[model samples]
Target chain A: MEKLFYFSDLFGVAVFSITGALMAGRKSMDLFGVLVIAVITALGGGTLRDAILDNHPVAWIRDDTYILVATLAAVGTVLWVRLTRPINETGLLVADAFGLAVFTVIGTEIALQHDTPVSAAVIMGVMTGVAGGVMRDVLCNEIPMIFQKEIYATACIAGSLVFIGLLELGVAAWIATCLSMATVLLARLAAIRWRLSLPRFHLLDRI
Target chain B: MEKLFYFSDLFGVAVFSITGALMAGRKSMDLFGVLVIAVITALGGGTLRDAILDNHPVAWIRDDTYILVATLAAVGTVLWVRLTRPINETGLLVADAFGLAVFTVIGTEIALQHDTPVSAAVIMGVMTGVAGGVMRDVLCNEIPMIFQKEIYATACIAGSLVFIGLLELGVAAWIATCLSMATVLLARLAAIRWRLSLPRFHLLDRI
Candidate 1:
């Protein structure tokens, strides 16, 4: 179980790195900028989660493996894009959905282990799933898509709540993890397919 | 000295909150958005720095005073702007410089206390001084002003180095702090006045 968890975390890092690299490419950023953005997009969420929880020796700094995976993934993305046709948009979206699911579970589990309040744990889970993408969008000089009406963060929130609820009801840990991850992945993919989104905030219009 | 440091930190929070609220105002964000941005701009830098240094119970979480100051400052700015003429642009710039100076020194000092390597300490200092603004700019859908032809981060780097160097040379703690803060403030203000900037990266253009 531990091994699976670790590898899935690395998998999340790689997928997010690809998304980040593609965004940097769109901006015509140089190789250095591409790598930096990719790494940040991959690790920024977990870093913020640990920092908020005061988890010592943040993941990448402690293991170095996560950083290596992110760097190699980023470089590989750049080479593949340069040498071949652009990656399929739909494929990238699916990979990103999986990444988001994995990260949200891991973040929630870690927060629970640290005995954080339930509300804080859920927020940490959502932050873990989306903060990296937020940083990536910000660096690319765009409003974060999550804040823009995408059902993205909503999926994470639902997954986190389900995970916590299942655990509280005495479900097996692995079963809860798997079910919750599926919840996020399916929700995200369905949203993408159907163009679903939360209603846009229009506080100013009302005022 | 501790009391002085504490007050200056709160002052920095207030100034940064004002800048954040002002930026949100420019975007015509509603009150809730303005308050959210202001709090983030005020606290985000320190949060990142402490997280990087593995400093536990992140400053604001350990004490709610910081959040209170930030909230009040944000609301006050909104009220002031609504009731009066627009804030003086030059004055806001100067206040931001002071906030940068204080945050840099505080970040460096905290890192040193943790026995972090000097290089990491310096990086933390710069992160503390500017990460919030980076986040603020990103939220507002703009490339960070610091990244785009501004000497903002350079000033933080200089102040952090000066602070560390003075301490290494056995300067009194208070003197080191004061001189370093002044270095950042003066450098930033001068850069603003003279439109100083680092040469833009043209890596792709050259290739």
Candidate 2:
């Protein structure tokens, strides 16, 4: 179970790094800018989650492997895109959905281990899933994609709730993790495919 | 000494919150958005610092005072703006500069207490000074003002170095902190007054 979690975390980092690199390329950022944004996009979420939960030595700082993986993935993506055709937008979204699902489950489990309140656990999970992308968008001078009507954060919240619920019902850790990941992945993919979205909170409309 | 630090911390929070609220107003964000940005601006830097330093139970989470101060400041700014003319840009920048100075010194002190290396301590100090403003700009969907050719971060780095130097010279803790804060404040103010800036990193030109 531990090994599986570690591998998935790295996988998520790699995918997020690739997305960040692609975004940087679109902006025509310099190589240094590309690398910085990529690393931040991959590590920002987990860093926030650990800090909120009082987990020490932030993941990338503690285990050099996380940094190495993110940096390499970012560089590789830049090179691949240059050599080949640009990755399709749809493909990028699909990879991002998978990364979000894995990160949400991992964040929730970590929060639970810290014995945080369920509400806080769910919040942490959603933050872990989405914060990095939000950071990336902000750095790129765009409104965060999550704040759109898209079902992104909602999917993370739902999966986190499912994971906690299954655990309370005595489900095995591995089973709960897998089921929750599927829930998020399916919701996100459906949203992408069908343009599903929650109603936006437009305060101006009411005022 | 501790009491002084605590009061300064709250003052910094209040100033940063006001800056955030004003920025949110300029962006035409809703009241809720204003509050969210204000709180993040006031507390985000300290939160990151604590998390990075392995300080458990983060200061704001450990004490309700920080949140209370931030909320009150945000709401107060909204009310004040409604009752009066918009704050002048220069006034806003001056207040932000003071907040930056205070936060930088406090961050350095906390890092020193944690026995961090000088380089890490310097980085932490700068982060604490500028991160809240960076977050505010990001949320407002603007490129961070710090990245402008401004002397903002340079001031923080210089003050952090001064603080450490004074401490090494066996200066009183209070003296070192006060001098450091003054150094940052003066440097920032001078930059604002004179339009001082560092050289821009024009990667495109180099390429």
Candidate 3:
């Protein structure tokens, strides 16, 4: 079980790192800048979770493997982009969906283990799934995609709620995890396919 | 002594919150957006510091006063801007300097309490002082001032190193705090006055 958890976690880290590297590459960031953003994108969410839960020695600082994977992913993506001349946007989109799904489930599970209220757990799950990408986009000097009505954070919230609800109903952990991940992955893919997004919530000229 | 620390901490929160509110105002953020930015700006740095140091529950989560002060600062700034028409650049600048100085010294002290190595302590101090503003800038979709060769993070670094050095030299806690805060305040104010900044570190399009 622990090994499965680590595998999924590292898998999400690698995909997110690639996305981060590609974003930095597009911005013409230096290698160092690319690596920094990659690490922040891959690790920032879990770090936030651990800090909020008071779990010491944040995941990256404790394991080292996460950082190592992120570094490799960043370097690998950069090289691929350099050689290919253009990014595979579709592939990137698919991988990002998987990353979001995996991260959201893991975050919700951790929060549940800590016995936080459902609302707090849901919030942490969304933060974990989306905050890293937000940090990445922000560091790259862009508004976060989640803030752009992209159905991003909403998907995380949906998956997290479903996961927690199932666990509350005494569902097996493995089954619950699979169902939750599928929910996020499919919902995000559908949103991408249909170009679905929430209406912009502009506060009309109160200024 | 504890009262003094609390006072300084709350003061820093208020000042940073105002600065955040002002920035959000410039971006034409709605009242709700303004408040969010204000809270993040006030609390983001210390949150990052505590997370990195493995301090759980973060300060604001542990204590309600930080959130209260931030809310008041945000509302007050928004009201002030609405009533006054133009934000007072000079007043905001001075208060921001104080925020940076006080937050830096306090962060250093906390890290020392955690028994971090000197380098880590200094890093936590700088992060605590400057990261909130970085987060504010990012959320407002602006390039962070610290990243733009502004003498912001440098000032934090200078003050933090000085504080830790003094503590090592057996300086009284209060004296070290005062001196360190002064260092940051003077350095930042001078930077603003003279328009001093670092040379831009452009990565010559290796992509």
lDDT of 2 by residue, B65-166 (tens): 887899899988877776665567787788778888889998998899999999999999999998988888888788888898579999999999999999
Candidate 3 structure quality by residue, lDDT tens digits, A1-207: 778878988999999998888788889989999999998999999887877778677788888999999999999988887787677789889988999998999999887787766766776788789778878988887766565545777788799999999998999999999999999999999989998875442323433
TM-scores of the models, in the order given: 0.61, 0.61, 0.61
After best superposition, candidate 3 residue A60: deviation in angstroms?
A: 11
Model 1, chain B: what is the TM-score? 0.96
Candidate 3 runs further than 4 Å off: A1-47, A51-126, A135-141, A148-207, B25-36, B75-85, B138-142, B147-150, B196-207
The segments of candidate 1 whose C-alpha lies over 4 angstroms from its true place after superposition are A203-207, B1-55, B59-134, B142-207
The C-alpha stretches of model 2 lying farther than 4 A from their native spots are A1-47, A56-141, A146-207, B82-85, B199-206
The residue-level lDDT of candidate 3 at B81 comes to 58
Q: Which clashing pairs does model 2 show?
A: none
Q: Candidate 2's residue-wise lDDT over A108-204, tens digit each?
A: 9888887776766776788798889888988898766665546788899899999999999999988999999999999999988899875322222
In candidate 3, the residue pairs with backbone N, CA or C atoms under 3 Å apart (3 or more residues apart, or in different chains) clash, namely none
- For each model, chain A TM-score? 0.97, 0.95, 0.95
lDDT of prediction 2: 0.85
User: What tens digits encode model 1's per-residue C-alpha lDDT throughout A46-136?
Assistant: 9988878878789998999999999999999998988996688999899899999999999999988977666667767988998898889
